[model samples]
Target: MSEPTNLPVDPEPIREILKNHQQQIRLGLRMCAHCGLCADSCFLYRANDRAPEYMPSYKFLNSIGVLFKKKGKVGKPAVEEMGALVFENCVLCTRCYCPFGIDIPALITLGRRACRSQGVFRAYDK
Candidate 1:
């Protein structure tokens, strides 16, 4: 609903946020190998006829991982797009079974919480 915010030009705030949540963010990003196993585990993916966007790994990798790569220096529009994956789409089924035993739900929740901290809640989130 807003234009590009041009946020965190200095990188300090992004760096501080990275310091705060570095471990899980890094862990989640590293653990996922994009094998698409978690996609089969997600009910949304199943119900949606295996649509690519409903895949948990796809959502997190594209949204949260992208944010981590950008070091949290995202605009409002970016956060909203991330929210589509992190909040609107995920049901947090805790079924994103990583063969590596990574906690997909936790990582996605972390992203949602980070967005929440930024007052980026979508009206559709229950």
Candidate 2:
């Protein structure tokens, strides 16, 4: 595995994307309740069977929590990390469901969209 290189670019465009999709992002966050029922539906949790951090709600909370704490003043690095966790790891399969009938995968999709707006999407595969 090689170390990742940071790309040089202004984040203004990315910030605009995030700003444009703010409503959808907020909707996704509002759907979660930290119920933990979705834990069993996660592939990471099922595969490892040891790490609670693999749960979808936990992952979403960590990323979205940063936005809340900072009052939506996140920088590129923060958005990038959130994108990796929510997009790459979770699979966006909608298998994780809460007791209140919340769909975790859908919420993750919203997170990805928010991250994507900030140019936090994965690099193109060559």
TM-score of each: 0.79, 0.68
Cα lDDT tens digits, model 2, 19-115, are 6656654665686666677888777888977476678887766665455445557666677778778766777776776776555665566567656
In candidate 2, position 60 carries an lDDT of 66
Per-residue CA lDDT of model 1 for 1-119, tens digit only, reads: 22334453344544565678788779888878878877788888899889898888877776667778987776766676777778778878787788877788877876676566555
Q: Show pairs that collide, candidate 1.
A: none
Clashing residue pairs in candidate 2 are none
Question: Candidate 1's C-alpha lDDT?
Answer: 0.73
The deviation in Å at residue 4 for candidate 2 is 6.4
**Worst 10 contiguous positions by lDDT, candidate 1:** 1-10
lDDT of 2: 0.64
